[model samples]
Target: MDLKLQKFLESTDFIRAVKVTVAAATPVILFSYLNLFSIGFTVALGALFTFSSDIPGNLRHRVNGMLASNLIATGSTVVISLATINPWIFYPVLISLVFFLSMIAVYGQRATLVSFSGLLAMSLSFSHSYTGWALLQHAGLMISGGLFYLCISMIFYYIRPYRYAELRMAECIVLTSKYLKLRGTLWDIRADRNKITEELLSLQIELNETHEKLRETLIKNRTKGGSSNQNRRLLIAHIELVEILELAMATSFDHNKLHHTFQEHPYVLNAYKHLAYNLAALLNELGQSIENRKKYTGKHRPFQDLEAFRKAIDRYEKQTHTSGRPTADEVLVLINMFNYVEKQAEKIKVVEYTFTHALHTQEPKHKDKELEKLLTPVHYNPITITQNLSFSSTIFRHSLRLTLTVLAGFLIGNILPIQNTYWILLTIVVIMRPGYGLTKQRSVHRTIGTLAGGIIAFGIISVVHNSTVLGILAMTCMVLGFSFIQRNYSIGATFITLYVIFVYGMLTPDIQDVILFRIADTLIGTALAFTANHFLWPSWEFLSLPTFLENSIKATRDYIREISVFYNRKGEVPLPYRIARKHAFIEIGNLMASFQRMTQEPKSRQKQLGQYYALVVLNHTLLTSAASMGSFIQSRKTTKASEAFNAITGAIINNLENAMELLKEEKQNIPVDKETKEMLKLRFTELKEIRKKEILESGGTQNENFRLKMEEGQLIIEHLIGLTNLSENIVKAVKDIRERQ
Candidate 1:
């Protein structure tokens, strides 16, 4: 099957869309048959809003979120419906409600979704003509509908508890597969390193998000009684997938440097690239099998490829010795690259084994608090909201911006003599986000989708006026709209517009008026949103870049410290080390996302973009090197921590610390002694000579352990040196940016 089609068919989005559509359609169908279409419409609206909070999670939180959403949406509808009794009462009530509802987003993603439901309810309340007892009954039906949808969610979850987690794991594998293919391209010297770096960082950000959600689903479930055979297997596969990402990240190299040195050794590079491509192919196949719920039958011969790749490097090492070109650094790089590939191959095999064989081996369980730290924190306290009431809070500022923009939109709608004036408020509520870049992007997408949907819906209504056919089309659009909302917002908007038009066509005689008003109101609302976000307290990415960079540096430093300790006491990867690794990746992802957002903003808002880009690249490389060093130490049997190792690692850690300090405009005094630097340089030279001698002596006929020890020492020293240099460069970049500021 085609992968795109397969993704859609097997995706959680598709399943959730089916559930959401059913939740919405059930009430409408039943009530319309009984001639209570208005009540059914209200119920369907309630179900739709409540289902928005049904994000993937453990059973408890998922239910709690939906319950909260139902209560908020129901309460908002009742309050706003009654507040519309007078203009003075309506104005203040609407403004305060929208602001407070938007402010609730400070709690977290689930809260944000729940908050959106309340805001949406309040906005839609403006369209209602009911009053008093009728309004209360409408609210009652809404609560019933929300509860019904909650039951559906619970039923689906209990029927297939691990389905979401399994799908997420499959997604992780697929992302890692794509990442591997991109990583492979780095071996090609002529490839655009800058473009690839940007793409790789973007992919890492997506992977980090997926990994976090999976942690919430899989780890949280296991701790709360989800340790069945299937859960164990999926957990093991998830662990392997994370290790594969680390291994893939570690495989990154300074391609320019490697190309400069190995200009004559293109074949060796091709060998590495080919092996990487094959590994990616294997991962792709593995992900497909996982998605299809089938055991991974071994198909690709990765071992043979590994053997051939290793021999190719060996042949090159021999050639370097005969030529006496002094390319020892480049040769060691090739060896380390080979070692990184070997680690990934071993991890992939473990994942395959976990899938193919009966799962008997149990991975160690994390304590509750430890597992909690892996997932995104959710705050429910009122104090959390109070703390964010200040203007300094981005959410607070966004709330104000949203409130003011909505006020302007409302006034314009009232003055323009347009029917269904609430359409303007609806557009504003849907299009505006906390960040300017996203608001701008969404405004454009909403405008385009509304226009296109209007045109398409107009054509459909022109030819086919049958109400039954239109109802089916509306249901299908609702399904598509829910499915694509998170995956692709523009497409989601298009389908949602189609659904709205079809429904309004059934409700009113003037189908063309509905379509025209929707488009015009969207344009007006999006323009107001865009203008408000730009002129109001816009959350510029540059202002937050320093914190992101500092966090990444600190995480990277802690990770290097863990690696240093492991060098002295080599064993299984400690929980602390894993935590540090996770923090490092997450922070790096945050930084990348910030930089990407900055790129989308106005050029004038892009402060020191070039310097920030340099820092991003150097920081990325620094963390990659740290991961490589840590991975090597954990996987290999090697000598204890040498003094030279301490000297290099100490310098690297100090450099990172200094960079963080520079970001904070604090004085930095850490410095390595001249003698220590000279000693480290001499020690590295001695290690390289020993490694070369071991390789030449082995010549396909010597002690494997001895050769392996020499190789480990050589690679470890090189990684330490490269990391130190990257850290120093990062400090310089930070200093430059600080000076400019």
Candidate 2:
């Protein structure tokens, strides 16, 4: 194969784009042939529109954009067609209307808004030439086309639900595996920071997208009942597992950074590699189960004793090298890696249990309580009105801002005393955003794109004035070209400008001056949008950032406490740890987005950067502590001295709960003090002594049962100590950071 072909084949993005193009265009083609009005242009335009909720960082924007565009298009088409009389007046009016609509589309929440604007622009512009009845016919036709497209999309969604589910599951597994591999490699050597950052970002993006699609699937599956419910529960569990795994990965990153000097430790490297392989295997199996839409029955087999594997590796490393204190980096990495492995194991165990329970159960309502308990711990709440409202409010505010700006532009156009200047007002209404900041960023790109596009369109018209065939071909090429460049804002804008100019210019050659006026109209829309966003309904990043950071800290603390209790009691750690991990991920995600938005605010540069980096460091610390706690738990023997260990574990949990409460209250500074620290130390020491005495007493009894119990008890005690140490440190860190603020 040629290099170009090889490159194309290698690009999954390109493949996905092709799939979307075919899927979107196919319906338009079918409808057009069925005498559903000329959908040729609409099909091409829709195909060029690649915004989907399935893409991370783009969903909220796209959805909001779509709603705004739809409203503008529907409103503009109805009002403009009814009022406009002559073509001379209507032509400029329509162009001005579209120009403004384009601005709103750009400034609004999503790319869908742009599509709506395109539809309105096309309908209103074309309808200007139509008589009264013909205009109504055209409106009906356009509405039908829109409905058909939506129906097709929904149908496709249902028909291939499993494929999407499987794909999401597979992607999650791939990410977890990559994270494990990266951690292991980091243990062997100091890893490239840029590469690691890129990988982490990519995983974040992929996970967000997967999560959206999963939500959609769950919604669709709800009406199907029974098996669908089972699938939904499993999918939710899968998502939780991925979230926990991510926290563990973050821990690994922190460990590697803190323990850079110990990257080459043989024992650390061995343990990480072994743990990575096990996690990868487990993820692969889970993915397969999802793909097959079957229960994960493999868990019934004898579980792999990760602790024994770690011990063996440790023994081998110790035998080969003289004992010495590990460098700070090595210790950090080792502890982090061990912690991650432990969490991963716990996640798998919970998921396995959930699947097993579902498989054996017969009654649906009877299983609800059990299912609720399992899911509550994983942060898998079914979608609710409140959640929807919160998400919608963000978009609604942005859209309303844009709408006001558009209204302002229309008022300005009316005052200019230009023929069909009402179109300019419509244009303004369509183009303006809710805030000044977004408008400013979008205007710069839009202007450049429009200018370049206008020049190209003029050239095409001058070169092929009489050749309709060539004009249509140019349009087709532009559509495909724009689709390819849509990922880049400047490129997308340039192509869109060129495409729109060509379409409008083809309809009126005599008014070449309209291009200059259209540019003015766009500027007006941009100005309105920017002003509205900055002055009206302005969102402060600080409003959400503190809460997000605080919640994340609390979640981290909760996770530590749960793991500690689980180790000490030799009982199942309730679902809260998993839930806490999910909440923490969500909080981190919110913090990142809040910071990104804040960076756009004037006088926010230093604050945003400082806060963001601080949050990052905090997250890193939390992950490291969690991972270390995991390893500490796994290394201890617990069965024999279970009672003593349990008591200590209970005390630790109580303290952790208190610490979490204080942290939540922003009073984390109510210090542990010397007395508290000494008390904890004394209790831990007593627990250890009790375990030792039990071991000594059991030594003469060849009874395997007594020996096993002693070992179990010892492990439990060690695990509890690790958990308490981690919780205390994290609480202290949170307190320190809060006090500094």
Give the number of the best model, judged by TM-score: 1
> What is the C-alpha lDDT profile of model 2 across 643-680, one tens digit per residue?
44545555555554555565455455564557756766
RMSD of 2: 8.7
How high is each candidate's TM-score? 0.92, 0.64
The count of backbone overlaps in candidate 1 is 0
Candidate 2's C-alpha runs over 4 A off are: 1-139, 154-163, 166-170, 192-202, 205-209, 218-247, 250-400, 415-444, 466-486, 510-518, 535-537, 554-580, 599-605, 623-741
Provide the overall lDDT of each model, using Cα atoms, as 2-decimal numbers: 0.84, 0.52
Pairs in steric clash, model 1: none
Ten-residue region with minimum lDDT total, candidate 2: 50-59
Tell me how many clashing residue pairs each candidate has. 0, 46
lDDT of 1 by residue, 1-741 (tens): 876787787789888998888988999999899998878888888898899789898778899999999999999988887777787798899889999999989988888999988988877887876697898888888898899899888888889888888888888888999999998887775789789888999999999999988888877778887478887787778878888998878765777877777778787877777778988988888888888877677678788889988999888888977887665556667777788888888888888777778976665664545655666666688999999998768899999999999899989998996787788888889989988899988998888888888999999999988899999999999889878887888898899999999988888889998888888888998899999999999888888788888998898899899889878887777778888899999999999998899999999999999999999999998898888878888777787777767777887787787788777745543354678567667877776776677667665523567556666867776787788678878977887787788
Backbone-clash count (model 2): 46
